[model samples]
Target: MTINIIDHFNEYFEMVPAISDELKLEVYKLRYQVYCIENLFLNPGHYPDNLEVDDFDPQSVHYLIRHRKSGEYAATTRLILPGTDNPEKLFPLELYCEIDNSGVMQPINREHLGEVSRFCVSKEFKKRKNETHTLAAIGPDQQDYFTSDERRAFPLISLALIACVIKVSHENDIRYLYATMERSLLQFLSALGINFIKIGPQGDYHGPRWPTVIKITDLLDCVAEKKPNIWNFLTNEGSFGQTRPIEKPSKAVRSNSWVGT
Candidate 1:
């Protein structure tokens, strides 16, 4: 039987145009679930209650999915515009990243560039893989967990977000795309056909680290082959984004935010 990927995906709302209180609480809850419950990042606070949310929250565009039946925030993510307001253009390293801001070369051209960060799934959606380790599939409900289906979904969402980010950049009259990331995720992105330039390293454990200069047009070109499947959400159980347990998460740096479903 054919599967409709988006069908399992809950209702999503962009946290831009306006900020609803319900939206705010949902996003914070997702943050608490992932950052606090899943990956305790030492800096504990009641802010997100489950995950982490810093000053960046105010400056970024938020995205969320909710249960149509319950209207609960299921999954959440935020995008940081390269320049304008967002420090990513200037520092690339996210909130936790620290550098001599005066000495660092800030990002340029607010138009085409943006950083994707703080992605999280609500804890209610997260599920544990088998003891041996494997991926999870989209079940009846929820959004925050890194199930096997999401592993497949992340790249697709990243690609779509990249496209949207660029499209928005064009509308905003900006050019050039840039974001700092890890060597491993960059490798995975490269396998999916994204070509990026290294911008050298920057930041603390909670900040942006080994950075890569991602050329958006070039990335689109490499991934163009799977455009239809990706754009159409042709994702399935055996997709490239299969979810797996983080046996040694510290070994490989993950840029996407967390949400345990």
Candidate 2:
């Protein structure tokens, strides 16, 4: 079947920036639900207000994906930028994990680095069989839930979230992004043609996670080459500036290396 991924995807999911207090609260609450209630990755009692927020959130930018038909949030992710006032605070990944930057192509500056973290998909919205205790009472038979088109669109929730991450980082002028993700999830994204370079040893966080990093241009380059439809969606059909082939960092920019220690 020749599926137009972007067209099918747009009919179901919409990305909302968590700019205001209300929207940010929604992101935190959803994180609490997914990480605390569903996944047991965090203790529910730790969040007295039922919002899973942390210190890094103050300087972070967030995004939420909504399932339009149901008017419910499907997933959320955030980019933690360096502290504007202090500028010495480290990213969550750097504080927690030992990132081997030897393989890095350029020296990094703290001001230019942003950490992508707190990614979660609401239990009810996911279609995979292995997960349970979801808000959405999905039946045993996955085929019975929605129409074929809807089925095709359902899985796009996660990808749409990633697209939002790319979009938000570009808007903020952040060129380098660090993330810690399950190796399996990384592999899955690679299967979808989104790849990140592994830079550290896999460690047990909530689960087995590997520290990884990606350049904005590299991400755009991969999408444009491997998944044109996704590239179109990310760039809004070339309007978002991701359509152009990504160029290497110029010598001048590389010289000033703002990569955080």
Best by TM-score: 2
* TM-scores for the candidates: 0.56, 0.84
Which ranges in model 2 have alpha carbons more than 4 Å from their true place? Answer: 131-143, 245-261
Candidate 2 has a TM-score of: 0.84
lDDT of 1 by residue, 1-261 (tens): 643334323122111211576666666666666556555533456653453566667656665644434545545555566556443344335344433432233644445556665544444444433211101112333334555554444333333334334434434443455465544446555666666665555544433345445544455445545443333332121122323222212211111211111
In angstroms, give how far residue 205 of model 1 lies from its true place.
3.2
Off by over 4 Å in 1: 1-18, 46-52, 67-72, 82-89, 92-108, 123-177, 180-184, 202-204, 207-209, 232-261
Q: How many clashes in each candidate?
A: 28, 8
Q: Worst ten-residue run, lDDT, model 2? A: 252-261
Itemize residue pairs with steric clashes in candidate 2: 108-258, 108-259, 109-258, 109-259, 109-260, 110-258, 110-259, 110-260
User: lDDT (0-100) at residue 6 of candidate 1?
Assistant: 42
> Candidate 2 on 1-261: residue-level lDDT in tens?
655566567667677888888998999999999889887888999999999988989898898887778979888899988788876787888788777865683676767788888877887666656545432222233544566677667666667777777777777777888888875568667865678888889886666788888887778777778877666656545545654643322232112211110
Evaluate all candidate structures by whole-model CA lDDT and list the values in order: 0.44, 0.72
